[model samples]
Target: MENSKEQVIQLNLNLIVARGPPVPTIPVPVVAAPPTITVPAFRSEKFSVPEQFDGTRSKLLEFTTQLRMKLEVNHDRFRNDAAKVIYSVSHLEESALDQVVPLVNANLAAPFSSITAFVANLEALFGDPDPRGTALHQLVTLKQGKVDFATYYSQFLRIVANLDYNEKAKIDALTEGLSEDLKDAMTYRTDRPDTVEAYATMLMTIDN
Candidate 1:
């Protein structure tokens, strides 16, 4: 029995010796790759108003719209931030900057609160208010003549610029200004456009 127990212990020792020593674990040094940053492709494409704008309120608004659209498209990273927008405006040329800076500076406390108020303030300075109503009445009565359609429409646009008419009123005023034959033809058409600009474009197209 003692011999059998000794044989069992020797067998266990042989098994452990046959299996090599446990592998020594070595800590691996892992290096993290640096993060990649994507820069805007149009980073160098600076934006500014094309020319020194006239003091016309509509023109000023139109210029601002164009500049805003460009910024939104090209500089999307900072487009929604008003501080970035104003910072971009600051870089405009002196002549172009003059057209907008004075107005912006005047309302420094809350510069962009209301577009309507901003435009109205500028309009008061540049746009003549036709309060007496004589000019608008005369303009509405004027009709197409020996003059081409472009000339007639130009006069129509000019007159409407001075008055504060809603879209419907503007369309009605334009329709009234048309010559008798043109007015009849437009009235008969089922597809006549509702907007003044569309109506004018149709007139110009037909006249041409």
Candidate 2:
């Protein structure tokens, strides 16, 4: 029985020796890096608030322009119509502030359904009554006498654009503003331009 026991122990020792020591595991790292997160463009920069508005017709246009630019750039900052309206109202003074008092107090019951409605009201209250008429009067007197063709063209275009004149009217006004030398050159061209853009190009070529 002792011999049988010794034989069993030796057999177990042999089985243990057959198997080698266990290997430890080490994890391999990933080759590619994680994606980078990007922040919003507007959040990176600072913007100034628009200047206060005092209900002056001449300054109204400038005020609205500044306010529009400010709101458009950081749209996330002004998410809704009420937010935009409140921001604009904050910059008002005297008469302008007085005008929006009822709307501000009304809150949810304000007449302004949209920011556009609010701006239109402001324009009606303090904007040029006869803007087109004013531009037309200026256009009739504008002459390209001493200035270069390019300069005169830029000035003429700015005034005429405000009037929304037809193609024929644009050509007529363009021709009328030409210097004496250009007017003389126009008479010689057999293949004249029909469109306003083509006409402007023809005049530029002649001027050059």
By lDDT, who's the top model here? 2
Which parts of model 2 are misplaced by more than 4 Å?
A: 1-54, 58-70, 90-98, 105-111, 162-164, 201-208
How much lDDT does each candidate structure score?
A: 0.64, 0.83
Clashing pairs in 1: none
> Estimated TM-score per prediction?
0.44, 0.59
lDDT of 2 at 106: 77
lDDT of 2 by residue, 1-208 (tens): 9999999999999999779686768889879987898875556244677899989887887788788888877667766877777777889998988898887887844447766787788999998799899788989899999888889988888678678788988999889989999999888888877788899888888788
Q: Which whole-number lDDT from 0 to 100 does residue 163 have in model 1?
A: 77
| Most TM-score-accurate candidate | 2
Candidate 1, which ten residues in sequence have the lowest lDDT sum?
44-53
